[model samples]
Structure formats: structure tokens, C-alpha cells
Target: MSLQWTIIATFLYAEIAFVLLLTLPIASPARWNKFFKSKFLAYISGQASIYFVVLIGVLILCLLDAIREMQKYSNIESTDHQHLDAEMQGNMRLFRAQRNFYISGIALFLLVVIRRLIQMICELAGLYAQSEANFRQAQSATVAAKTLLEKQGAGDEVAKKDIEDLRGQILLLEKELAKEKKDKEAVKSQAESLNREYDRLTEEHSKLQKKITIAGGDKKDN
Candidate 1:
């Protein structure tokens, strides 16, 4: 039982040392700024460091008291079984106290470690969510831009088709204009021909009238 108690004490002290080492950076005022970004963290670290110091003092005192008790017990001569039983009872009480102290210390250390881990996890998750939101926004913008471009392309195609239709209409109008001009030229040529025929017939009629008058005069003289 004594040996077991000693082993438990040794293990508890070792665990305490390990926890202290792990907490050293958090507890150190000089190093606090490196890990913590908030005043709240600073305040929490200060409080936690004070608690850890008090717990260390208590554990040290308990270990010292346990050592003293063990020394005293060893010095006692085994006079009788009743005395032995009393000593055993005392030892049992000490063991129980030491066990409770070790358990509480370990629990406190684990709580602090777990809290820090959870904070880190939450921070990481927040960063990931923000990045994912930004990425989704960018993706949505890209899709919208693509959709806008497609609409513009469709508008351009429609405009080109309208331009082509306008060009075809212009060509048809030009052909009709050319045909009207050609018909107008044909009508003007036919009118000029009719005017020349009227002038030749009037000249022939005047010559025939002169010949008839001369013939009648000759008959009268005879």
C-alpha cells in the first residue's frame, strides 16, 4: 500500500509537471500576445495562471505532508496489531486525500486543454465557412456574368439578322427603282418618234395643195 501510494504520488507529480510545461506559454505574460488576439483571452489566461499556481502550491504541500507522515510512521516501532491498525487507517486516509487531489488536478488540466482545443476548432471552422461563402459568391457572379454575355450574344445575333433583312429590302428597292427608270426612258423615246412623224405629214400636205392650185389656173387660161 505504501509503495502504491508512492507510485501514485510520483505519477501525479509527473502529470503536474507535464501540464505545467504545456501551459507555460499560455501562462507567460511575455508569450501571451503571440497566441491570443483578444483582451478576453488575456484576462482568462491571467485568471487561469493564478488558479494553476494555487493548485500547484496545494499539491506541493500535500506531497510534503504525505512525505512527513510516511517518515513519522517509519520511525514508529511496531508495538502491537492495534497500533498497526491505527497506522494503516492513517495511511489509508492519506492515500484517499492524495488520490482526490491528483484526480482534481488532472481534471482541471484536461478542462483547460479541451477548452483551448475547442476554441481553435471553432476559429478554424469559422474561417472555412467565410472562405466557402466568398467562393460561392464568386461562383455565382461568374455564372451571372456568363448569363449576361450569352444574352448580349443573342442580342447581337438578332441585330445582325435585322441588318441582313434591311440590306435585302434595300437591294429589292434599288432593283425596282432601276426598272422604273428604264420604263420611263422607253416612254420618252416613243414620244419623240411620234413628234417626228407629225412634222413629215404636215410638210407633204402643203406641197400637194400648191400643185392643185396651179393645175386649176392653167385650165382657166385655156
Candidate 2:
């Protein structure tokens, strides 16, 4: 094989190996995403579109050349049967052309497939990251709710204590009011007894004065 054809064969084999590695589940999507986003790959990816176009164009040209070579050799083999040596050389050339055609076609196909696989891996990694963020948000919200409930419970306890204090104050005021009412009633009873005693003393004094006046009148008449 010529040096050019050997190099193409080697490139075709490499493409096949890369395709197999992508299809196999050896690495996770996140790992693949990280690898593709690395500095070296990112630099290569920056010019990936140009590279893709150039590679595809070269492959297409090679495929067309191979097809033309195959057709030309086939025509020569069918028409010039008298020259057996020439016919044998033509057959070998035809075989090489066919091989080249297949190699180029397969390499082109695998290139597109590799690009699609990388895109899919990147999308899957993004989805995983988004889901993790949502889960964290949910956890934070749950924590906030728990804290709010704790605060509300503390407020309720404080309100209950205040209500108990007010009830104690009311009980004390009722006891003081009852004691004052009893003292007022006792003072009223004492005042009524003193008034009655003064009335009885006045009546006795009036009777004594009347008796003295009656004794003096009897002496004067004697």
C-alpha cells in the first residue's frame, strides 16, 4: 500500500475505536462532559466546525476518486481480456479502490456520530446539575419551614404565660375587694350601736330632773 493509503487506513481504524469507546458505558455522562469541556478539547472544539468541513470535503473527494478508479479498472478488465498481466494489475487496483471507498465512508459516518454523542453527554450533565439544584432548594425550604414552626411555638408559649399572669392578678384583686367590703360592713354596725346608746342616756337624764321638781313642790306645801 502507498503511504497515503496506509495513513488513511490507520485513521479509519482510530475512528472505529473511538466510536466503540463512545458506545460503551465505560464513563459517566458528567465525566465525559468534563473531559470535553477541558481546555485542550475546548480549543479544538473552537475550530471544530472548520475541521469537520475540511475533513468531510477531503473524504468525499477521496471517495469519488476511488469510485472513478473502480469504474475505470472494471471497464479495462472487461474490454482488454487479451492482456492477462494488465488485467491482473487492474483487478488489484480495483480492490484497493473499493477498500479506500469503504474506509472513507465509514470514517465520515463515525465523525458525525461522535459529535452527536458529545452533544448528548453535555445535555445529560446539564439535566443532572439542574436536578441537584432543585433538590437543594427543596431542602432549604424544608429547613425554613421548620424554623418558622419553632418560632410560632415559642410565641404560643409566651402568650400562655401572659394569660396565666393576668389570671393571677385578677384573683388577687378579687380577694382585696372582698376584704374591703367586710371592713365597711363592720364600721356600719358599730355606728348604729353608738346611736342607740346615746338615745337611752338622754331618756334617763329627763326622768331624774322630773323627780327633783316633784320633791321640792311637796316640801313647799308642807
Candidate 3:
């Protein structure tokens, strides 16, 4: 029984790990287009949450079935009970240990999901900070270029050269600003994806709650 349980646990862990490994591309900014990365990650996270609930429910059902079977085997045959047999007692202990192991494994898997979520948040924060710094630097460079252009006189050759240099500087700053805008757009796209996911999950939860309430009322009426 222990060996069987060990094999089952190993298989479940491997499957969960494989699903988690698919999230690796999310860490790379280059992997993000307008649609793929953020949407994919949100989908995976939402699916993971759904599966987590399902797996927990299955685990509980399995536990309840096991307990029911154990009770059947433990039925007293006479006025005085002899207690459960040694083998049955040992099997009970094994079942309990395996159940605990499975519960712990599921908890660990949840922690992995949460850790990945936190890591993603931190990465976004870092990227936002970098983008802000780039914007400020670009703004300062633009101000410097305007000041230089204003101070120069249009007649002197040296002043013409200075103006040309400033013009070049301003062009470079504009290119940098364009790049920053692109990055900002990418970030905005991701934020919108997250918002859409939040709305979807909220709607799903509300519907689920209503279904549960309706089912409970039906059960009481029956």
C-alpha cells in the first residue's frame, strides 16, 4: 500500500510540476506580445485554482469512501467485540499516513503557485520602476536640448554646429521616448489582461455561489 501510494504521489507531483514549468516563459519580457504572455499566465493561474478545488474535493471523497469501507470491515460479530485485526489496524495507519502525505503535498503545490505569483508581481514592479526612470531621463534630456537651442544665435557657424548637435540629441531622446512608449503599451496590455481575468473569476464565483444556494434549497425541499 505504501509503495502504491508513493507511486501515486510521485505521478501527481510530476504532473503538477510539468504544468508549472509551462509558466517559465512568463519571466522573459521578450516572450510577451500584445496577447500571449499575460493571457497565458492568467489562464494557467485560473485553471490551477479550479483544479486545486477539484482535486481537494476528490481527495475528500476518497477519504470518506475509505472510512466507510473501513467501518464495514470493523463490524462487530458478537455481543463483545474483539477489536479490529492487526492487519486491518496496520492498514488503517497506512491509510492515515498516506492521506496526510497527500494533503501536505497539495499544500506545497499551492505554495509554489503563490510564490510564482509574488515573483511575477515583483518583476512587474521592477519593470515599472525602470520605465519611470527612463521617462524622467528622457524628459530631462529634452529640457536640456530646448535650453541649448534657445540660447544659440542663428548667425554664427559655431552656433549652427551647437544647434545641430542639440538637434541630434533631441532626435535620440525622441527615439528613446518612443521605445518607452512601446514598453508602456506592453505593460498596459498586461494590466488589462489581468483586469479581464479578475472580472471573469469574480463572475464565475458569483455564479457558483448561486448554484450552490439553489442546490441546497432543492435538497431541503426534497
lDDT of 3: 0.66
Q: What TM-score would each prediction reach against the true structure?
A: 0.53, 0.75, 0.34
Give a tens-digit lDDT track for model 3, residues 1-222. 556455546656765775565456644433332223376777776677687677666555645555565455445232254556855565676566557456445645655564565556557766876998999999999999988876664446777788999999999999999999999999999999999999999999999999999999999999
Candidate 2 off by > 4 Å: 73-91, 186-222
Model 2, position 131: C-alpha lDDT score: 93
- lDDT for each residue of candidate 1 in 51-128, tens digit (9 for 90 to 100): 767756665565566566655554442444566678787667656655545554564455456457546645765677
Question: Candidate 2, 78: how far from true, in Å?
Answer: 5.9
* Candidate 3 residue runs with Cα over 4 Å from true position: 1-12, 15-49, 59-96, 99-222
The number of clashing residue pairs in model 1 is 0
- Candidate 1 has its poorest 10 consecutive residues by lDDT at 26-35
Tens-digit lDDT track for model 2 on 63-105? 8888898898888778847677777888899899888888878
Better of 2 and 3 by TM-score: 2
